[model samples]
Target: MKVNFKLACPLLLAATSAFAGGNNEPTAHRYISERIAQYGEAVERCEKIAASRPLPDESVIEQLRDYSIDDVRIFLITRSSLVSEICEKPELTELAYAIGVLEGADISGTPKEIVQNIKQLVFGEATWGLKKKYLELPVSVQNILKKTDYFDKPFDDIAILNAIENAKKP
Candidate 1:
């Protein structure tokens, strides 16, 4: 009995000291409210970012750089002439979303949005399509996409797939 009590005292003291430090975790209500507040702040920031951004397709052509929205509508003839030169719908409907993302991104933007958009598209689309399509796209289309303002440098299949996998971690 004496030996058992001696060992248990030290063990109990260690646990007591740890308990005395108090739990770093918050209550369930506190955690939820904090997360909600964070989400609200994030939405506000994203709204501001989305507002300042242009429609993106306007920058595809060099000569049209100076044109405003009205200029494009009034001066530019039928269909803007750059659409067919860039992309087309995918063969499978399941792949359409990814194709559309690449096409939308194929227009124009900063390298940051381009990279992040590509990362997210590949990530999010895989959840729906159940497969990744970046590498499956034709080489020619890939080349055209590569030249677009959307495709950032180091746009490789491995990198994109890696991003998708990493995003799944807790």
Candidate 2:
């Protein structure tokens, strides 16, 4: 059977969530919750900034987290929701999406695909300006970018944005 990887990814994530305790773990989401708590201030700060300053590329910054693959998935899910209820804009959420994409590509994808993905992300993921805004990204998103290595090179939002806007993708 030919499985659709895109559709299967969410199903796989659901299965992973369901079996979160299959390994005799004490808590499936305790770490996640604690991380949110740990970075609570930073996250709120970022959200506040995003709300007060909706532009993505402005010279500013807030929000936070230390995480794993599963954590990124959770962040993607939850942060997406947060844009509607907690924040006025989706810059932080979009950053989460970018991190998720880059992380997934890092795990399994080609350079060409990642190039295209990065290009796409820069387009709608935020306001067009990348200089000041990229510098002001939330602590959590920055950490993820640093962690998600592309071709063994760390993912830099400014560099990727510049590549997409000025130079050839990748």
The reply for model 1, stretches above 4 Å from the true place, is: 1-26, 57-145, 150-170
Name the regions of candidate 2 deviating beyond 4 angstroms: 1-15, 33-45, 53-170
Model 2, position 72, has a per-residue lDDT of 39
Please name the candidate that would achieve the greatest TM-score relative to the true structure: 1
> What do the candidate models score in CA lDDT, each in turn?
0.32, 0.34
* Every candidate's CA RMSD: 24.5, 18.0
Clash count for candidate 2 is: 5
Tens digits of per-residue lDDT for model 1, 1-170:
11222343344334433222223212322322233234334333433443344433434433233333333332222121122111211212223343344445432222222324333432354333322233343444334344455332112222332333354457
| Superposed Cα deviation of residue 26, candidate 1 (Å) | 7.3
Report how far off residue 115 is in candidate 2 (Å): 26
Q: List the residue pairs that clash in candidate 1.
A: none
Clashes of each: 0, 5
Worst 10 residues of 2 by lDDT: 56-65
